[model samples]
Target chain A: MRKGFRTDLRWSDVTPKEKWLNRRQLMAGAGALVLAAPALAQGTAAPGRYSTDEPPTSLEDISGYNNFYEFGYDKEDPARLAQGLTVDPWSVVIDGLVDRPGTYALDDLLSGVTLEERIYRFRCVEAWSMVVPWVGFELAALLGRVGVQPGARYVAFETLLRPEEMPGQRGGTIEWPYREGLRLDEAMHPLTLLATGIYNEPLPKQNGAPIRLVVPWKYGFKSIKSIVRISLVADRPQTTWNMLQPNEYGFYSNVNPQVDHPRWSQASERRVGGGLLAPRIDTLMFNGYADEVASLYAGMDLTRDF
Target chain B: MDGAASLNGALRRVPVWAVCGLGLVPLAVLVWRGLSGGLGIDPVKTLEHQLGLTALQLLLAGLVVTPLRRWTGVNLIRYRRAIGLLAFLYAALHLLVWLWLDLQLRWSEIGADLVKRPYVIVGMLGFACLVPLAMTSNGWSVRRLGAAAWQRLHRLAYAAVLLAALHYLLLVKVWSAEPLLYALAAAGLVALRWLWRRGRSGTVRA
Candidate 1:
């Protein structure tokens, strides 16, 4: 009975051909609508709407699709098989160029420390990427507590080597006892975190359980997993990938799109789970953290140094 | 001897149409599952994994036909066409899932991915080799091409099998034991074929 909402209709609005094209257009429009509707609804939402300053990316996605060489060389193998590993009763042997040198249990190291969540864009050397909300204190903070000496120019991290735990170690696809290294300055960067947990949970076995390093500016592999030792050395330490293919993987291993990997292009990265139509996002210099960390390698040629 | 005779009678009685339909069952099931939303939430991953596994299964089945014929003297020649066609069906499914769900009709991206990813390149090469084998499976093509030429062209299936295995291996960021085992099995089949050829030629010369 209320005439207030009465709508005006024209004869042209109901044409059969137009209706058919409209249906086709509606079908075509559905894809864009699916992607856009949620974003729009959440834009000017209620007071209790959950939000975080962190980017819409997660460490779970990154860690879930890891290629941990120590566990296995397969991308999904670590996720499938690393669950067999025992992460508890783990201890890290910290020595060399530090004032205090002794073994520290993983729990003891993690118990009293304050953990903070920092959202980071992780770029893999293979040119895929994800946003990760990593929970850990700065590596510099931990190093400060350990008291590093002036002569320490590099920091080397080593993964555990028990063939019983890591079955891949039984066969020699790579030299056993995987190792990764970082320059002293790189290790001391504020963003570098010795991560022990992610997404408010203990690190998954596949994602370098017990402990791992997170150097955000570099390629993902530079962040070593299942670390058993951290040694401060006076010389540059030999990294596993660098040792394997010196030309392809350099010691620095910064995320530089211009410097392509030998087998693949590094100019762009596919955000996993992004539907087929989502164009690969162009990779940024230093993985979009260039402003914060590029000063560390101000003059060095990244292509050559890498 | 009685069982063998019955099997021969069964083979003779079973209509070719029925065998063809049976051969198509795997593809039909896949299509049904794909349309019914039974392939799980991530359709692409589900399809990719299923097609990949099926491709491996069909390849192994094709390999087994030869050894089985020799070992049991079962005359498995009748099954060879069906097995090869099934292999092509799985391979076609694999390519379709990749093109539709993974690449999504982005011709440029598809082209780029095929060129950029070594695994994709190898997979395309394997699929290319399968086209000829599938086309020439019919009796008409065999007769038109002549038996000698037909045999020569169909021999490309061996190369297709190897390429498919390589494609699987190269796809993963790191090597897994499962795929490696498949590669070893494929390699063993190829080795057996080579050994059989050598033995046959040696016997002929003697």
Candidate 2:
């Protein structure tokens, strides 16, 4: 590793995001304000270790805008069309090279680990980005709970496929049931999260509902939303974007500003909630999470892997 | 046929400049949207798409002038030049928004995109086709170049409109009906003359 992915900054040294708020009434206004609460409840937890002190993106922008192709192609389509999606009584199937392989209810699967708030920098492959305050436990905790098999080298994730509610699926926008994967080491990385909430509120239907993965270092698509199936496999699994266009997207979609997408420049990004005032800010190495996740791809050339 | 002729005669009194001025309505809506919360989540993107769509829609409307005169006998031919120029204005504004607001004039990256990305190339070529047409959209230029040569030069609008539609269609990461519909409409407009002639050649006199 050129420079170690280690920050000397302690969790306590960094201020809690709540302290950054100018007004106390803002606490009540936190998270997405769209309609009522979601059907499922993962319950709230205390702030986590890796929470960024940066002022988070507004809940309105975070929940209102989305890239959920299952809902539709437009950013607004998810909010407009995904309201009817049924996320209650959800379950996730843990299969492949796990010691215990079975369908577990959403609550049971996420039962043991303590959920905590982690405000992270989220960068989309389209070169737009947001800093979301996500609430969840690390994927490592879940993998530990499920018990990874000896030969498992990769972790594949699949999103919930419900066509009747998701009209974009009816249009054959994708192959249906979007899939994503990560190397075993990447999956087990402490920074890798399976989020249940945003801004300490239950995730909205448009913003990946019951459960979603958040890999802060990678492009937003790599953090597959509304995940249902998680497989610990011996081989690297196919991903939706990678399978669609391998030239553009890659399995190791770690945010490297050096590598540019065909459509979007990875060198910089338009901040989603920054409005008209803010100019496009320069993108950082590993989206500024380089200190945390850089070691994972130590010797590999990201330009080639990307 | 008499009703169509009367409607066409009445349309002539509305003034071509008034119709061209009415094209600013969409831009006004855009301004209102930017002021209010209606520009959606990413306002830059919403603004860019709106301007681009308005340009395409106006270009298609200009294309329909001939078909309307031929088939329906509603001659909008008087307002065609104004409509075409207004469409060019919107297209230029769309390019400006993309450069200034969206890309922020990152010339090096923009140059790379023009070279590497097919959609960007398509959009650039479409805009390039409009530049000459827009520059020469004057009576003096028409007189200098002569009507025949000017008309030949103006055919670039067809290529520009088709490319604009294709740019939109290609830009989408997933299959979307909206862009596809626009593409289909553009294709129909581009082939309108040939399609109309083939259907009428069997019976109808010019």
Candidate 1 Cα deviation (angstroms), residue A166: 4.0
Q: Any idea what lDDT model 2 has? A: 0.83
Docking class of 2: medium
| Candidate 2 TM-score over all chains jointly | 0.88
| Candidate 2 lDDT for residue B109 | 77
| Span of ten consecutive residues with least summed lDDT in model 1 chain A | A42-51
Specify the CAPRI tier of model 1: incorrect
Point to the candidate with the largest lDDT.
2
Q: Per-residue CA lDDT of candidate 2, range A1-306, in tens?
A: 001113343434433435433322344466533211321121234567787777788888999989998988778899999999998878899999998899988878666567777889999998899989898889999899889999999999999988888888886647879999999999999999989888656788899988899999899999988889999999889999998889889999888888988675688889998676456888999989888888888999888999
> Per-prediction count of colliding residue pairs?
3, 0
- Whole-model Cα lDDT per candidate? 0.73, 0.83
| Candidate 1 per-residue lDDT over residues B146-179, each given as its tens digit | 9888988887878888888888887554455877
Share of real interface contacts recovered by each model? Answer: 0.06, 0.61
For model 2, residues B59-168, the per-residue Cα lDDT tens digits are: 89989887777779888877888888888889999999988999899898788888988888999999999999889988999999998789889889889999999999
